[model samples]
Target: MSVLRIDTSIQGPRSASSALADVAEAEWSAVRPTTTFVRRHLGAEPLPADAWAAAITGGPLPEEQRTPAQRDAIALARTLADEMRHADAAILALPLYNWGVSQHAKTWIDLTIAGAEKGERLLEGKPAIVLTTRGGGYGPGTPREGWDHNTAFLRRIVADVWGAELTLIERELTLARVNPAMEALLETAELMRKAAHEAASHAGRAAASSAR
Candidate 1:
């Protein structure tokens, strides 16, 4: 089986989202030792800024009539889509940026969608897990309830647009230990982080089982 893992944390090894993703991937590897793994580190290699616009406007045009930029854009989109199409499962690690979606993640989604034909959902029914880390709490009843602007947008693209069977693993209060302003919540944050890792492990095993 093949699994595609996409990491969008600019923090690299220090990112909570990526740490959880590592747990998930490790669990999957333990269960399926021979599974093919594909990794895309968007933070380290972001998509070209103009690629999305070019792909959206040029994809429907005949190849012969496409401009060079359009050609390259469409080609890139196709490459990303092909990875998803071939994967038996996927893990996306995304850290909330300023309470919103990461620009790199958004670009990836837009480009992937642009590559698909009309009415096509290339990743339909594919098992996909999303690991998200937020600096603060935003659950209901919290002071910042409804403040999270990323999750809904991600769900729309991952589930509604691509038709992936989605599972979300969220770790909030991620800045508690690092940011002095959140020092009081350090204990809680540690607990949440632990829970998130445990959840990721379970999700990974489930993904492997489903793929098998």
Candidate 2:
């Protein structure tokens, strides 16, 4: 089995979402020791800014007619889509940025969709886990309720459009430890973080079992 892990956290090692993804990947590796792992660190090496637009416009054009940049863009999209098509399971680590999806993640999604062949859902029915972290609370009744603008969009693309069997592991109040304004919520933040890790591990185990 193969698992594709896509990391989209600008914070790198300090990123809570990335750490949670590691926990899940560790659990997955525990059960499937020999499973192939493919890592794509988008935060470190984001796709070309113009790749999505080029791909969308050039995909249907004849290769000979496409500009060099367009060709490169199309190729990049195909590579990204191929990773999804070949993976048995996938993990996407995303940190909410300004209550919106990261440009890198969105670019990847757009390119993937543009590259997909007709009637092809590369990740159809595949197990896909999304690890998301937010610096502030956006839960119901919170002052920021309904403030998250990315989760639903992400679901629409990955679950609805790509048809992946989805699971979400979310952690909020992530900035409580560092943000003075959230000092009062530090204890709750710790608890939420711990729970998120546990949930990630559980989901990872479930993914491994399902793979078998």
lDDT of each: 0.89, 0.90
Per-residue lDDT of 51-102 in model 1, one digit per residue for the tens? 9999988977999999999999999998988888888889999889988999
Instruction: For candidate 1, report its TM-score.
Output: 0.96
Q: Can you tell me which runs of candidate 2 are displaced by over 4 Å?
A: none
Consecutive 10-residue window with the lowest summed lDDT within model 2:
113-122
What's the lDDT for candidate 2? Answer: 0.90
TM-score of each: 0.96, 0.97
For lDDT, the strongest prediction is 2
lDDT of 1 at 37: 88
As for candidate 2, its clashing pairs are none
Candidate 1's displacement at residue 178, Å, is 1.5
Candidate 1 Cα errors over 4 Å, as ranges: none
lDDT of 2 by residue, 1-212 (tens): 99999998899778999999999999999999999989989999998889888888887899999998899999988888898899999999988898899988988888888778876888888889999899999998999999899888888877888888899989999999899999999999999999999999999989888873
The candidate that wins on TM-score is 2
